[model samples]
Target: MSRLLLLSPLLLFLGLAYLLPLSGVMLQSVTTPEPGLQNYSAALGDPLVWSVIWRTLRVCLCVTVLAVVLAYPLTLLWLKGNTATRVLVELAIMIPFWLSVLSRAFGWLSLLSNRGLINSWLQSLGIIAEPLTMVRNEFGVVIGMMHFLIPFAVFPLASAMRSVDDRVILAARGMGASRMRIFWQIFVPMTKSGIVGAALLVFVFSLGFYIVPTLLGGGRSVMIAELIYLRIFQIPNWGLAAALSALLMVSIGAFLVALIKRAGVSTT
Candidate 1:
C-alpha cells in the first residue's frame, strides 16, 4: 500500500502531463469538422495519406534492419574488445546520445550535400563526374535514422549478452562445438530477446522521428510526424491534424500488439 501510494505522484503527473494532452487532441479530432469518424475514413481513403503512412512504415523497417545488422556486430565486438578498445567504441556509440537531434540532422546534411565533405573528397579524387544525390532523399533519412538508432539497439543487445553464461558457452566449446556452431546455437538463441526488444524500440523511435526525416529527406520525404506538423501549422487543419495523430497512434499500437502476439507464440 505504501509503495502504491509512493507511485501515485508519478501516476498523477503522467495523467496530467501526457494523458490529458493526448485526450484533448483525440477529443478535438472527433468533435471538430462535424463530430463524426469521417476524419479517419477520409484520411485513410486518401491516396496521399496512405502513401505517407506506407513511406513511414518502409523507412522504419529499413532503419530497424540496418540498426540490427550494425548493432549486433558492434555489441559482440564490444564484448570481445580490450578495455581501451571497448572504451573508445562505447564512447563513439554514445556520441549520438550526447548530440542533439537537430545537430545530428544538420551534420548529415553538411556531410552528404553536393558540396559537402564526402562530395568534395570524391570530386577531388575524380571518383565521380558529379556529386551524388545522397542528401534530401530516402537514403539520407535512412543514414541519419540508422545513426540515431544503432546505439539504442546496442543497449538491449548488450544487456541480453550480459545475461549469457560464459561457462555454459565454454562447456559447449569444450564439447567440440565449433565457434560458428556455438554462436548460432547458443549465443544467438540467448540474445534474441535483446534483438527483438531493440528492433521494436528502434522501430517505434523511427515512427516518431520528425527532425532527421524532414531535414535530411529535404522536405520531399514526408513522414507521419511531419505530415501532422503540416496539418497543424501550415495546412492549419486542426481536425485533420488531430485525426492524423490518432491514426498514427492506432497504427503504431496495432503493430506493437502484433509483435507482442508473435513473440508470445514464438516463446511458447
Candidate 2:
C-alpha cells in the first residue's frame, strides 16, 4: 500500500503527459474534419502514403539487421575483453549517446554528400570521374539511423548477453566443440532473446525516426513521421495527420505486441 501510494505521482504524471495526449490524438483521428473514417480511408488508398510506409519498413529492416550484426561482436567484446579492451569498446559504443541526433545527421551529411569528405577523397584518388551520390537517399538515411540506433541495440543485447551462463558454454568447449560449432549450436541459441530484443528495439525505434531521415534523405526519402509532419504543418491537413498518427501508433503497438508474444513463447 505504501509503495503503491509512492508510485501514484509517477502514474499521475504519466497519465497527464503521455496517456492524455495519446488518447487525444486517437480521438482526433476519428473525430476530426466532421467525423467518420474518411481520413483513414484516404490514407489507406493513397499510393504516396503506401510508398512512404514501405520505405520506412525497408529502412527499418536494413538498420535493424546492420545494428544486430555490428552490435553482436561489440557486445561480446564488452563482455569478454580484457579491462583495457572493454573500456575502449565501451567508450566507442557510448560516445554516440552523448551527441545530439541533429549533430549526428549533419556530421554524416558532411562525410557522405557528393562534395563531402568521402567523395572528395574518392575523386582525388581517381576512383571515379564523378562523385558518388550517397546522402539525400535511402542509403544516407540507413547510415544515419544505424549510427543512432546501434547503441540502443547494444545495451539491450548486452543485458540479455549478461544473463547467459558461462558454464554451459564451457561444457560445450570441454566436449571438444570447435569454435564455430560452439557458436552456432550453443552460444547463439542461448543469446536469441538478446538478438530478438535488440532487433525489435532497433526496428520500432527506427519507425519513429524523423530528424535523420528528414535531413539526410533531403526530401527524396520522406518517411512516415516526416509525412505526418507535412500533412499537419505543411499541408495543414489536420484530419489526415491525425489519421496517420493513429496508424503509426497502431504499427508500433503491433510490433510491441509481437515482441511480448515472442517473449512469452521463449519463456515457456
Candidate 3:
C-alpha cells in the first residue's frame, strides 16, 4: 500500500502522457480505417514508405557511428586530462545541451550552405572555383545530427571509461602490453555497455528526429518522422500516419531489444 502510494505520481504521469497517447496512435492505426490490418499492410507494402523508413535507419546509424567515433576519443582525453583541461572539454560538451534543437539545426544550415563558413574558407583559399554544395543533402543531415548526438554519446562513454579500473590498465601495462593493445583488448570490451547505450540513445532519437533532418535534408532525403508529418498534415491520411508511427515504434523497440540483448543487460 505504501509503495503503491509512493509510485502513484509516476504511474499517473505515465498513464496521462505516454501510455495514453501511444495507445491512441496504435489504436487508430488499426481501427480508424474500418477495423482491419489494412493500414499496416498498406504501409508495409508501400515502396516509398519503406524507402523512407530505410533512410531513417541509415541516417540514424550513420549519426550513431560518427557520434561514437567523435565522442570516445574526447571522452578518453577528458578522463586523462588535468582539471582545467577536463573542465574546458566538459563545458564544451555541455554547452550544446543549453541550446534548442532548432537553433542548432539552423546554425548548421549557415555553416553548411554554399556561402557558409566552410565553403567560403575553401573558396578564399582557392581550393575550389565554386562553392561546394553541402546543405540539403544526406551529408548535411549526418553532420548536423552528429553535432547533437556526440555529447549524448560522450556522456555515457566518459562514465564507462571513468568506471574502468585503473589498476587493471596498469597491470596490463606492467605485463608489457602495448598501450594500443591494452586499450583495444581491455578498455574497449569493458566500455561495450556504454557504447551500446549511447548507440541506442542516438539511433532511436535520430530515427524519429524532425527538426534537424527536415532542415538539413531539404526534402532530398525523407526520414520516416518527416514522412509521418507529411502524411498526417499534408496528405491528411490519419490511418496511414498512424500505421507509419506504429512501424517507427516497432523498429525502435526491436533495435533497442537487440542492443540490450547484445549488451547482456539483465532485466530481472
Models sorted by TM-score, best on top = 2, 3, 1
Compose the digit string of candidate 3's lDDT tens values, residues 1-268. 9999999999999999999999999999999768999999999999998888788878888999999988998898788889998999989898999999999999999998999999999999999999888989899999998999899888778777878899999999999999899989999999887887888878877877888889999988889889999999899989989999998888889988887786575233
Per-prediction tally of clashes:
0, 0, 0
* Per-residue C-alpha lDDT of model 2 across residues 188-241, encoded as one tens digit per residue: 888888899899988999999999999999999999999999998888988889
- Note the Cα lDDT for every prediction shown: 0.90, 0.92, 0.88
Error of 3 at 168 (Å): 2.0
List the candidates' TM-scores in order: 0.89, 0.91, 0.90
- Which is better, 1 or 2, measured by lDDT? 2
User: In candidate 1, which residue pairs get closer than 3 Å at backbone N, Cα or C atoms, i.e. clash?
Assistant: none
Off by more than 4 A, model 1: 1-16, 254-268
Candidate 3 error regions (>4 Å): 1-14, 258-268
| Candidate 1 per-residue lDDT over residues 165-229, each given as its tens digit | 99989999899999999999999998998888889878977898999999998889899999999
Best of the two (2, 3) by TM-score = 2
